[model samples]
Target: MYVVIFKAKVRQFDDQYSQTANRMRELALTEFGCLEFNAVTEGDLEIALSYWPSEEHIKAWKQHPEHLAAQQLGKQRWYESYSVEVVEIKRSYKSGSY
Candidate 1:
């Protein structure tokens, strides 16, 4: 499994951001083969983690038209700065199943 971690400093958020974010999450899961997606924000900081089966899926999601538009808007208005990291899972252990 692969994980994409997106950490950022938020700027502004409103209805449009909410709608786009939900839509993008759906697209990533249903269309791009994302295994799981989670995100959280506190104060001015935001962090999102998306799990994938392959890097190709992540690349495709990054280039998706709607996602590209959202990225542009993020840079223009939604986020102040961001960093993305892609990592491979080496091992995993879960204490409980949900």
Candidate 2:
């Protein structure tokens, strides 16, 4: 398994950002084989994490046309700065009462 962690310092977030985020989430889960996706924002900071089965899938998702456009928009208008890290998950565990 792999996890992609994205962190950003937001410059602005308008209705377009919200709508595009919702659409991208749907596209990622339904079309990009994203196993899990999570995002949070506080003040100017935003973080998003997504899990994937393989690096190929991650690369594919990164190159997706819609995602590419979003990236450009982030650079141009929405994000002041951002970083992405892709890590291999060697082990994972969860324990709780369902």
User: lDDT (CA) for every model shown?
Assistant: 0.95, 0.95
**TM-score for each model:** 0.97, 0.96
lDDT computed for candidate 1: 0.95
- Give Cα distance to truth, residue 3, candidate 1, Å: 0.3
Kindly list the per-residue Cα lDDT of model 1 for residues 1-98, writing each as its tens digit. 99999999999998999999999999999999999999999999999999999999999999999999999999999999999999999997888775
- After TM-score superposition, the amount by which residue 66's alpha carbon in candidate 2 deviates from its true location, in angstroms, is 0.7
lDDT of 2 by residue, 1-98 (tens): 99999999999999999998998889889999999999999999999999999999999999999999998998999999999999999999889963
* Model 1: CA > 4 A from native: none
